[model samples]
Target chain A: MGWFKRIKDGIQTTTKDKKETPEGLWHKCPTCKQMLTTEEHAENLWVCDKCEKHHRIGSVEYFHILFDNGRFKELETSLKSGDPLKFKDTKTYVVRLKQAKDKSKLTDAIRVGHGKMNDQDIIICCMDFNFIGGSMGSVVGEKISRAIDASLKKKIPLMIISKSGGARMMEAAFSLMQMAKTSAKLSLLAKAKIPYISLLTDPTTGGVTASFAMLGDVNLAEPGALIGFAGPRIVKETIGVDLPEGFQTSEFVLEHGFLDKIVKRKDLKNTISNLIKLFAN
Target chain B: MATLIEIEKPLQKLLDQLDKAEHIQNESDVDVSKTIKDLKKKLREKRKEIFENLTAWERVMVSRHPDRPYTLAYINAITGGDFIELHGDRTVKDDKAMVGGLGSIDGQSVMFIGQQKGINTKMRQYRNFGMANPEGYRKALRLMKLAEKFNIPVISLIDTPGAFPGVEAEERGQGEAIARNLMEMAQLSVPIICIIIGEGASGGALGIGIGDKVLMLENSWYSVISPENCSAILWRTWEYKEQAAESLKLTGEDMLKNKLIDGIIKEPIGGAHNDPEETFRTVKEEILKQLKKLKAIEPDKLIEKRIKKFCAMGVTK
Candidate 1:
């Protein structure tokens, strides 16, 4: 059978077998059309085993994968966003926010909390790129600020894994204010003698990369992640020049020494745990 | 595609010879110190005649010189011995742009925090051009609180156009970080000394700018917002940044005159990049002098001083 047909058959079979509905599935090996099941794909962290092409995972799944036995206490989740500008640049700000909330099933773009990676207590704040491209708004700012506060209170360190598009335009000036707000929180952490490390994942860009994502005590990156303030395309357009090949990807960034380490997804848990243990002493 | 190639034998031979000429060019053709001294003499003569009416753009360029002494350089220059870096906000990732650690300056144990700008392309990317995010500021706060715990003095190096304004930064709470730092820093008991080493733009710089004694390097610039952003807002033209710079009064001289900075550390002729050693020595002396003055002040007085200093910023006539 042709590879495409086989993949189609696999998806059809999975859909037919599962009585419960799947949120949404877009699984395909670009190079080789191999039928892959979500169950089979889940094990590889959404990388196609046949072609090795990676897929984006939601923040909830990401936390589950990184933590031991899905053990994590979500902190500062109750914080809601305020419309600081009563902003009106595009469609109504409230409407866009409500849409983003519904689409991502999240109150804000990031999830911040404390969790154990191999039983090592650490703070984990993951940006949900799926949420309005993970544009940071007031709630995200408040949550991050609180996360740092929690870390300081607990005297533990933080690990932030970021995958984002940049600042949320709907929030306008209030969104811009977050840069200072977050930096101030970090200053407090510095004062408190706590450690905060950043894990730059795929497509970390804009205001996010400009701020906390780039401000890691020991910055790490996933293989092939894109890390920069502007996307290569946008920068090229703005600068009126072609970007060098492999300009902003994690490997290129690592080569340029933007990342302290280029860690593989499979090994990320162990690596972070080891670092946490080293610091704990 | 392969058939059109032609080899330039003569050119290839010359290129090969040129490649072997120098790997590491260490020896100077002229005596560097002597040449610098002569240059300084010329600068001094020129300064007396006419301190050239500097354009706002020139100040901006001066603020961004690659060779400018950054926070890390100052820390290394002022503090002797091995330094240990502390990490993590205990809730998120460690921030590289804002580096804080336990170290000794002139044999006295202290906690240090600085916004570090990397020298080369690699380091700049690593340090994010000293533009910290929420986490970097949080890390600085962590260090400050730690200093209070240990009763050690705190020194912060301020540089950066502003905090990172990216989606992730906002998502993670950039504004809250800066606000909390401003609020909490005012109450911290440790004697804090802040030195504006380079660009000190906007809230990113201010996040760690709350200090008992705030100093500015002669060539450094600090402002509420960067000239470029201001221009974009005021003129709807980023290119008009030069005009915005002039209006902002961002230079150390301007800031000192306005009482934004407590004092200015003299830089060598031209700029710090022109003579790093001289710049280093002068900064060291000034910082030591300031620290000594501050060491005598009680903790309550120190906090009060910091509060008063910030409250008084941008109070225009």
Candidate 2:
């Protein structure tokens, strides 16, 4: 009767009466198109339970997964990128940095943490693709350099979880020099006989791959991760030909004898711990 | 004659006029020697002015000028027919894009390595447009290690658009090859000098670019990405390449200002293509000077200094 009678024609509700579902409440698997709650997704370490596809995760997730009791001490948490080149392309580099910081809530593309992994002291520098595509700028370089020093000083193993789109273009030559800077530091790590594990995740390409990402004493990658010097699109455009399926994937790289092993996301901590133990002996 | 860029067009016109005047004075009985001399003086001034104030994009154009001198040209001129060419990475077939061998600069034996672009279209295709594949970088590493074995200082001339971007290049592990070079070159016990002779784009250039003294030739451009590529990425179009070049600050002066490079070697007015011999001479002198400075340090000290030098790069707050 109330519905039939238009007593309150155009029945109004106050703004406070409106209710809507918040974002990030549900997750959709890109590979399987399966729907699951966010909690379930997080419980699975962000990997798709239905398809076993490893969705790209940031440093926060990686640290929680690898660190002991999800506890760690962050290094250079305030180190930020300087506008060395004062670059501007549709937007000023400073503005872009601010925007990236605001959107990602990160200081830079990389975060270095000191913690015990499987009861073994380790220094891990993880890159976040959410921050400017995880492009290695001056700040990333400096942080990694410092991390290497930390590893050398503490006599602990070092690990880098690389998920990047290569060198930051806005920094220009400064970005290019980071490659040399980080590699030089890694050479010191090698000289120190410290175990340096490089973990390549999804979409690691460009200068990062050509520098520290590949200089690992033991190079490991996630399943189906994209790892290469050049992006597939650039390669395709340069060759003017169609790329075969699964090109530049972790499997392809492993087949090419570039990678040491392909470890699943769930087994990353144990596998890395085992590797550190092997290096220890 | 070498091809001229947009900024060099006026200089080219002036040069043509001077040529006509000289030809007329030589062929005929006219006494136009004064005119020829005046034209020559004017041409020199214009060239200096044009090159001295070149915009970043103009330098990029000059760096990529088809007639610009390539690595082999400099090696040949510097070594003066004393270069012994080496080939192959031992594990893979030889890559012509990369050329490395033993050479002497005024009887000082050195390992000369560089990326060599082709002189013509056919040769360009053969050289892969100066883009090295993984094997090319591997070959460079093999040569560097060989140089270290012989206690020879390594002089690497970097000039490349970037590493090869083909599927086979990726399959062959281009990134690892370059990465290995950076790590190995960092501690090679021998003095390493890297000179950016031209287009030093991203990791391709840095593949062999780590050194105690990293220098750049005037008119050469070095950056994380090529101007066109950067423009394409940031501006979503290549039309803003000039703007991108300015923003990138990729010229030799910019690199020196940023302390990314040790110094800038002056090129002949217009560019290296204008007077290749003079450019070669200046490069040889600079190399010799830097080599002398670097050679005085012991290997251990040299390695430490090199690492420190690179570690000091990058501005962070």
Indicate which candidate wins on TM-score: 2
Residue A114 in candidate 1 has what lDDT? 77
Tens-place lDDT per residue, model 2, A66-182, is 999999999988898899877888989999999999999999999999999999999999999999999999999999999999999999999999999998998988888888889
lDDT of 2: 0.92
Model 1 reaches what TM-score against the true structure?
0.50
**What tens-digit string does per-residue lDDT give for candidate 1 at B223-266?**
75677765664466788777667666677776666566788887
- Top candidate on lDDT is 2
Error of 2 at A11 (Å): 24
Q: Summing lDDT over every window of 10 consecutive residues in candidate 2 chain B, give the lowest-scoring window.
A: B1-10
Return the clash pairs for model 2, or none. none
Q: Over 4 Å off in model 2, which ranges?
A: A1-23, B25-32
**Residue by residue across A1-281, what tens digits does model 1's lDDT show?**
66554433335556558787465454566547766776778888776787655566767877988889878889876776666435343255677778888988897788986788897788889988888888776677667777887888989888888888766654543454465456556766766778888898888876666567767777898777777754555456544766667767777666655578987777888888898787667
Candidates in order, TM-scores: namely 0.50, 0.95
Best by DockQ: 2
